[model samples]
Target: MIDNLIQGVFNGVSTGAVLLLAALGLAIVFGLMGVINMAHGELMMFGAYTTFVVQNIFKSLGEPWSDFYIFAALIAAFIFTAAIGFLLEKGVIRFLYGRPLETLLATWGVSLIMQQFVRSVNWVILAGLLVFSILYFGGVWALQRRPNWDAIKNWAIAVLLPLTLAIAGSMGVFMAQIYKIAVTKPWFGAQNVDVTAPKWLRGGLAIGTLQFPYVRLFIIVLTIACVIGIYLFLEKSPWGLRIRAVMQNRQMSACLGIPTKTVDALTFSIGSGLAGIAGCAVSFLGSVGPNTGQNYIVDTFMVVVVGGVGKLIGSIAAALAIGTTSYLVGSGTFTNIFAGIKPLVDFFTFFATTSMAKVLLFVLIVAFLQYKPAGMFPQKGRSVEL
Candidate 1:
């Protein structure tokens, strides 16, 4: 019984990892501007379609869809989506600031326009355009931030695979040489690991009484690394502090001579970049569609809303908790009476049945808001400063 429960946890982590990225973006956007970016999901959708386009371009040009192309696609998605984010902020969002309801409705319309535009056009053709828009432009935008070595390395690898591969190889060598690092088993499952093999020949592993797929391990580590990286950036770096400052109070920071616009742009880009990474990671699980972002939109929003508005670590915790709970309910290890009403609730039916997982999510967030409205980790001095 313990082993089975442990195995179920392992299954949950992979799903949690993807949610982490999407949730992080949702958290940042809502936390900073108090603007519910209804179109954020569309941004992710753009990223996925952008990736699909990049891969296809490689095919048409007789180039292999190598890691380099993927890296390029990541940059593409970040810029394509982030640029749109910046424009939305400048064109529409900025005007609707402090008006969450209006921003929400306005962005919803924007999202519809974006969706229909993509749905109308062959999303496949637009992917390459998005890629180029991101690459040549993203590189410049990232450099404008005067980022550190890691950020520099990050952007460089997106356009340069040999560099990224070398970095990955170097990390493996470093991890190998480092004195025995004791990898601990989580309370929920065994330690996570990254998959090094290509897709066709990867995964399909079994450990002990439980099957340990390489795919699940890969996702867990990816999610963990992302969460840690963002935390480190926020806690340890000067720029991160500035970014957080802008996130907390944009006007005050701008008044204090912080290049607030630049910070806003960078923060939005980082959020969108995380979305791109999630899209890349999602490809490992299934054939990604142009509208892949739609599937995760509502779920990710649930994570951020429950986690609290502006907190990064909160989003991570919320994602894990929500994902784990959803999985448990799905497995039917235990059932709450509200579970049966999910399908009905989902269809906007008051008494009809809905998907158990989503219903639980809605209930959790509602409960979270009722009890801890500021969130698990609300930004300190938020009210005091305002």
Candidate 2:
């Protein structure tokens, strides 16, 4: 009984840690702007795949120190995810802000596109060129933010035009390499990838009567560390202050010369990067499927909603509650305790079945929300509304 109890609690904490990682990013973006980023899960998927790529690279090299590849994977996931988020904000999200339904729909569409992209590399060359064009001309547009058309045109011709052409030439060379791969590489077709955790993390830590998996412990520790780092970044750093200022009042922040637009883009990128980190952590938990993000997306959102939007402490508490209760209930701990009551035991068993657990969990959350719609820790100001 004691061992089971210990294991169950550990299970809950571990599960809650994953939920916290996944929700933290959503909390940052949703809490600040009231934008429901339906695509946040896909960003997590990007991180998982990034880790997958790193693992494969290390395997191909036949490196004995492959365990260290996770470091590279973590860095790559953060950078790639952050860059993608920045581009998405600039190209799509910025236009749809303040419109919750529209933003959600648009982000959902973006998520679908991203999923399809991983299954195909045939369009890489075209995508590369398009990216180059955007980067080159986008700078000119940024310079033209003040709307000096003649000056903008002159700058485009004198500077951006030549730079664009040079980049185009470089892209041509890059495309040739990609063309060769497209013609010859049979593995470029749509297929799912898998990631295997390093050998060092393959075991467990045993304590007198209880045992805990190292990977799960790594996840729990990593999550706590990340939460602390984010707290410092948001509360202690200048950029953090700028982000909070913009979130508190965008118009006022801009008036005070806080560069609200840039802050929005950076904050979005940071949030997206956090999701990427979650994805990398998830790679060790199970198979890195294309739809892995789909598994946790709803639950993480529930964490955000139940915890209270934009409230960090709320997210933590909700994650712990949801994570612990869901595990205890699904693990049949209560069912065993009530063994004498056949009907009650059967009822618990029914929901503990894999498919129904989520359904039952969601039903409970919906019921909870019916009474406290603003969540457990409701924000005090503009953050509570659209």
Best by TM-score: 2
Residue 110 deviation, candidate 1, in Å?
1.5
Model 2 backbone overlap count: 0
Scored against the true structure, residue 264 in model 1 reaches a CA lDDT of 63
Clashing residue pairs found in predicted model 2: none
Q: What TM-score would each prediction reach against the true structure?
A: 0.70, 0.86
Superposed model 2: Cα runs more than 4 Å off: 122-190, 382-386
Local accuracy of candidate 1 as per-residue lDDT tens digits, 121-239:
43232433355445545655666677474557665656654443454445444544553233111111212212122443365577677787776686677678888888898789988
lDDT of 2 by residue, 1-386 (tens): 66777788898889989889889888989977778888888999899988998888888877685877888998999899999999989988899888999999999999888876666544544555586678776876677677677766775668776777677667756766767655334332355566777888778999987889988998899899989999999999999999888877888888999987798899889989989989999888787766778888888999999999878899999998888888878888757766789999999888875567777888999999999998999878763454
- Tell how far residue 300 is off in model 1, in angstroms: 1.4
Per-candidate Cα lDDT values, in order, are 0.68, 0.83
